[model samples]
Target chain A: MRLSYPANVKIILVPCTGKVDVMHLLQAIQRGADGVYCVGCLEGTCHYNQGNLRCRERVERVREILQEIGLEPDRVRMYNLSSGEAPTFVAYAREMTELIRRLGPNPLKHSKPSIRLEEAA
Target chain B: MIVAKRKPFEEILQMIAGHRKVLIAGCGTCVAVCLAGGEKEVAVLAAEIDMARRLKNQPIELGQTTLERQCDREYLAQLDDRAASYEAIVSLACGVGIQFLAERFPTIPVYPGVDTCGLAVNQDVGWYEERCRSCGRCVLDRTGGICPVTLCAKGLYNGPCGGTNRGFCEIDPEQPCAWYAIYERLKGQGRLERIRAITPVQEWRDTVPRTLLQPGYRKPEKAKS
Candidate 1:
């Protein structure tokens, strides 16, 4: 019998988390991400005084843009994890994987059904 | 500085739907100082548009350029060599600059990316509020520096509205009641008594029908022998 491994998800890593620009976040959603989140240092402990805070603002703006485009804002998220928190990383992946399982494919994919105005209305 | 904000991404996408080549023009003037339509914004907008086009499988070429001053002929002339190459030009300048580009490049269509918000004062980073309407009148001497016509929300020239609560405007809780600010300024300068007299209704006709004039020029006359 052949052994099989569970499907894995990809998480983009950034420096200080604040470096993640709003355009990058919007592009990720536009390019079709199952679930996206920014993992940074704890609120006050950010290497940069407020890099995490900046990332939080960008995430909020991205959420607004998603809502404007009729997409679910909940699909995007933000979180923080310290370097030693390997378990926390695993938990995040698990949580995202489960959410992805329920969410299915990304709405931005051309293969998926397009958003209809009348139906949405 | 002339503060402005870009239209929504979808709105911009719709504006240049069928155009293949887009020239993103940025003005290094009031728009730049306000962090609105500067060079950085031009590049970001171009990238976003390009990404949107590629995502939809409709690839388009976007050329980005910034002018020292879009309203001046010297800055606009810098694009003479390459201006005709693009199908459309997206101007990230004030309304005046956008029209200037259109006049200089009559063959190409120019689309305004930013909505001319209003004359504003930057409170701080990422915070700006409209401060003046520039109704072509100057009455600040009597009313103190605070502009009652613009900042008051209701444009009341006399004093705070009845709805004012604890120095904030009723219209927007975040905004300071313009008339109240004016009153305080007058009190500080001992000009409170001077402003007690009501100001008359301003001639609003000057604010209507926008007009543009070329600098240092006069209409040519049709001469006869």
Candidate 2:
């Protein structure tokens, strides 16, 4: 199977997407990621049973946390696809990249210094 | 265990808005088990607050720490030196822990990060149900270990009210009638006779603000040499 997606997107593989935690997504945004999304095994087909479902829940939770903190919840998403469906995976990557491109860079990226200064004051 | 849930993020933002530096103190005991105010929750909250402050251009200095048990003086003592550095402290412990911190650090303001919900037992992963009202009485032996004070909406002592429909409570169809449950449980144990016994009016005095002093530990009468 051959497929191509945007080069800008980076992937971090986890043993199981269920292992993805709320903090992991928050940290990604804190570290300047304009957008983040999780690609998990298709719903109900997760090798570890509910791992994909758990990932989906975590993604939604992170989205809520983002909204609470004044960020657009659309910056993050969750997509499900089986291992054999490379085309769908590529499509999701392109879709996420397009979404992020529209959202622009994360607001917290350049404000690190100002935040620290205000904190100290 | 005492269960709680985090306050809405917007309310918390409003609370610490005036302070530039704030410390989020988490408890590693009950709140942690409930997934509300544990170490992981503290980190997530810290990051979210930092981002919110940054977004508002009102940047705040955030610090995070978790004590083994916020209810204990020994664990709270760990925050002594650092507590002074921050303008305010956001305690992620239950109501008790928050008050203790406020009393110990009279100079610093302590805000509650979580609302202490109630005494509950985990029904399933991420699910909890209240199990005890701390009514200052012991009736479990007669009630087949089910607590009517906590489970029954009316806190009926002798039996359920007429509001019971089948086995479900009238207040909510989803909830099983506590007295019905007690009846079934006792009947199964060949103890239905207990239900017929009239329970005396509960003494309300014991339910008031009360303290228990362990009788075993009295200061050893000044040891005479």
Q: Which candidate leads the pack in TM-score?
A: 2
lDDT of 1 by residue, A1-121 (tens): 2323225766566777989987687666666666687888888988789999999998897777666555667677787888777778677767767776787766566532221111100
TM-scores vs. true structure, each candidate? 0.75, 0.93
B156, model 2: CA deviation in Å? 1.4
TM-score of 2: 0.93
Off by over 4 Å in 1: A1-15, A23-37, A62-77, A90-121, B159-175, B197-200, B208-225
Candidate 1 per-residue lDDT, tens place, B1-225, comes to: 678888888888898998988888989888888777887677667756755676566767778877888888878888887889889898999998999899999999999999988898889986788878878676787888778888787888777779788889888899898777887888999888967787888877667776656899665585211
Chain A: TM-score in each model: 0.79, 0.89
Instruction: Find the candidate with the highest DockQ and give its number.
Output: 2
Model 1 chain B TM at 0.88
Q: Clashes in each model (backbone N, CA, C under 3 Å)?
A: 0, 0
lDDT tens per residue, model 2, B33-62: 999998888888889898888888888888
lDDT of 2 at A114: 23
**Candidate 2 DockQ vs. native:** 0.42
